[model samples]
Target: MITLSETSLDVQQAIQTATRLKAGAVNVFVGTVRDNAKGKAVLRLEYEAYEPMAIAEIKKIVEAAAAKWPLQGWAISHRVGVLQPGEAAVVVAVSTPHRADSFAACEYIIDTLKETVPIWKKEVLEDGEEWISAHP
Candidate 1:
């Protein structure tokens, strides 16, 4: 599954989707807004993306992960636009015949998404807002 929405993600739902495939292992990743980044107080965050490119890139990551791992199921979802502190920004889940594959594939998806996805974040601070790379 792949989706872009402003609504909150349901991890149970994601896991359910994965488990329905008779997977022996399931791995999940959830990224949330932190109150601070590099010691800078983060009042909130605003995310914007080149939607077409972002979605395409996300699909590519999912495909690569699936191909590289013996995955039985995969799902990735991301929330866009304004997000308050502590809200989830992204969720990824993977299920496979073995636990190791599930963990490795899930990590690959999230790390690659941060490195390759064309998503940008703006930190809203008490002083001002500044755009930053989605990855550290």
Candidate 2:
């Protein structure tokens, strides 16, 4: 499963989606908004994305991870729009026949998604807002 949602992220659903009977491990990664960044106090965060391109890039990442691991199932959900501190920004889950593979693939997916996806993040601080990476 892969999705870009404007509502709150469903973390348990992500984990359940990646659960497999043949799996020895199910690894999950959740990224949340923090209360601060650098020396500024963060009030909230707003995310935007090039929707079509972002989904396509995620598909490519999922394909690459599958090619590199013996994955049984996987799920990824990313939230868009304004989010408060401690709110989940992203969820990644993967099931594999072994613990090492599950961990590796889950990490790879999140890291690669961060680097390659077309999602952008803006930090709303007490002073003002600034775009973080302008790319995800």
Candidate 3:
């Protein structure tokens, strides 16, 4: 499953979607809005995306990871609009037959999503705001 939502992310929902009876391991990664970036105090984060493109890119990442790993299922949820600190920005969950595969696939999905998805973020700071690149 892949979704770009304007509402707050539901991490448990992602986990549930990825979990299956045959899977022995489930891995989840949740990214949250941080309070600070580059020593500046972040007031909030505003995320915007070309929704259709972002969803397609996320689906591609999931498919590639599944082909590389023994994955049973996976789900990715990315939140848009303004979010406060500690709110979830994204959640990625993957289930596999083994812990190693689950971890690897989950990591691959998040990394690839950051690199390839057409999602943008603006860091609203105490002093100013700036739009930053999606990837690290």
Candidate 4:
């Protein structure tokens, strides 16, 4: 499953969606807002995206990862709009028959998503705001 939401991201739901009985391991990655960036104090973050394109690109990443790894199921969700520090921005979960495969596939999905997805984020700091490629 893949989705781009304007509300809070539910990590538990993502995990449930990716879990499977046949899988021996399940990996999850949750990305959140931080209080600081590059020695500056961060207030919050605002995210925007070309939703259709972003979702399509995320699906492509999931498909490619599944082909490369022995994956049982996968789920990815990204949150949009304004978010404060420590709030989840995205979640990626994957299940596989082995621990190694699950870990590798989950990492691959997130790395590829950052590079390929059409999501934009603004870093709101005490000094000013800057539009960035994406948040970590």
TM-score winner:
3
Error of 1 at 65 (Å): 0.9
How do the predictions measure up, each by TM-score?
Answer: 0.91, 0.96, 0.97, 0.96
Mark the regions of model 2 whose C-alpha exceeds 4 Å error after superposition.
Answer: 134-136
lDDT of residue 12 for candidate 1: 79
Candidate 2, residue 29: the lDDT equals: 97
- Candidate 1 on 34-74: residue-level lDDT in tens? 98877778898888877899889988998898789988987
Report how far residue 65 has shifted in candidate 4, in Å: 0.4
lDDT of every predicted structure (CA atoms): 0.85, 0.95, 0.92, 0.92
Worst 10 residues of 1 by lDDT: 13-22
What lDDT tens digits, residue by residue, belong to model 2 across residues 48-98? Answer: 999999999999999999999999999999999999999999999999999
Tell me how far the alpha carbon of residue 81 in candidate 2 is from the true structure, in angstroms, after superposition: 0.3
Candidate 4, 1-136: lDDT as tens digits? 8988888898999999999999999999999999999899999999999999998898889889978998898999998899999999999999999999999999999999988899989999999999987443
Off by more than 4 A, model 1? none
lDDT of 4 at 84: 95
Which pairs of residues collide in model 1?
A: none
Of the pair 1 and 2, which is ahead by lDDT?
2
User: Who is ahead in lDDT, 1 or 4?
Assistant: 4
C-alpha positional error of residue 127 in candidate 3 after TM-score superposition, expressed in Å:
1.0
lDDT of 1 at 24: 86
